[model samples]
Target: MSPSGKPPRAVDIVRRGLLTRPWRSAVEAVRPPWSPQESQFTQACTRCGRCVEACPGGILQRGDGGYPAADFRHGGCTFCYACAGACPEGLFLPRDGRAWDIVATVTAGCLALQAVECRRCQESCADGAIIFRPVAGGLWQPQLNRSACSGCGGCVAGCPVSAIKMEHSHGRSLAGM
Candidate 1:
């Protein structure tokens, strides 16, 4: 039984996989910058790979279900908006505005938090969102300035511990271009 207290739908079964595998992530894919909302983008994208081709960073790749997704391990987004320009379906938002509401999240496994000396993530962030502030016991703790963040995934790749991930800011709007 599902949390809704009803029989799971066929889509749910497929989403949960062959029962041997763990349940799939609800956020199945990370679309290109300026992309429309998830459900809309999935329904409208032609899977043409135009946006993926236009991405110079090479971070955008064919993700789950063949949809475009960003892999920050390759590199962070430069916000060139070339992906938006290449899309024929207008699936992406206008480029005249901010790109998206995504931002970096550092988990407990972060090296610095674990008392390990590491500044790779801070050095990688061009926006200076990741700042190491001195704390008790002469330890420097990494602090995130959410306002200074552009959700560019710049900090994700440099984390040697892989403690960083991009998540929604849940702001007033996600109409970033």
Candidate 2:
């Protein structure tokens, strides 16, 4: 652990992974859409587990020891941004408006696929946005009720295989030009 009290071992493990994971590296390398709300927010975040500990939803976790990774599996982020408020480094940049600007996507490994009848993700959703529907093969597929989805990204973290993805929801549109 260094002066910030974050464990060196944990930091090293995350750093190594980020250095090797091209996809993750690419995302972090992308210039933030906007400057952090606080001038020191970007630099002061030590990637320590403090903010994560403060998270009541367990949605916030260490993302390469750099940013807050929110998983919206159990529930969506209430836009509370509590982790941001608790961050000592002020690294968590608040959008001030449009909290759903960050969107989380649940990938292939949905809980239903793991088990024929498991509705763990749906049940975990406090917003009741995820619905299970019978598909072509009588298999239940989890559908996102967009109106109910708040883009909390909590599902991403709870995933055993990290099948969830967090994406910027407000950017480019697919409408025909």
Strongest candidate by TM-score: 1
Residue-wise C-alpha lDDT for candidate 2, range 81-107, written one tens digit per residue: 556566566565456654544444556
List model 1 lDDT by residue over 1-177, tens digit each: 899999876667565567635434434456798888888888999999999999999989988677888888787899999998898888888887778768887888999999999999899999999999999999998999999998888788788777887778863211111
User: Candidate 1, 51: how far from true, in Å?
Assistant: 0.7
Which ranges of candidate 2 are over 4 A from the true structure?
A: 1-21, 28-54, 61-81, 84-96, 111-115, 157-162, 170-177
- TM-score for all predictions? 0.82, 0.54
TM-score of 1: 0.82
Q: After the best TM-score superposition of candidate 1, give how far the Cα of residue 25 lies from its true spot, in angstroms.
A: 2.7
Clashing pairs in 1: none
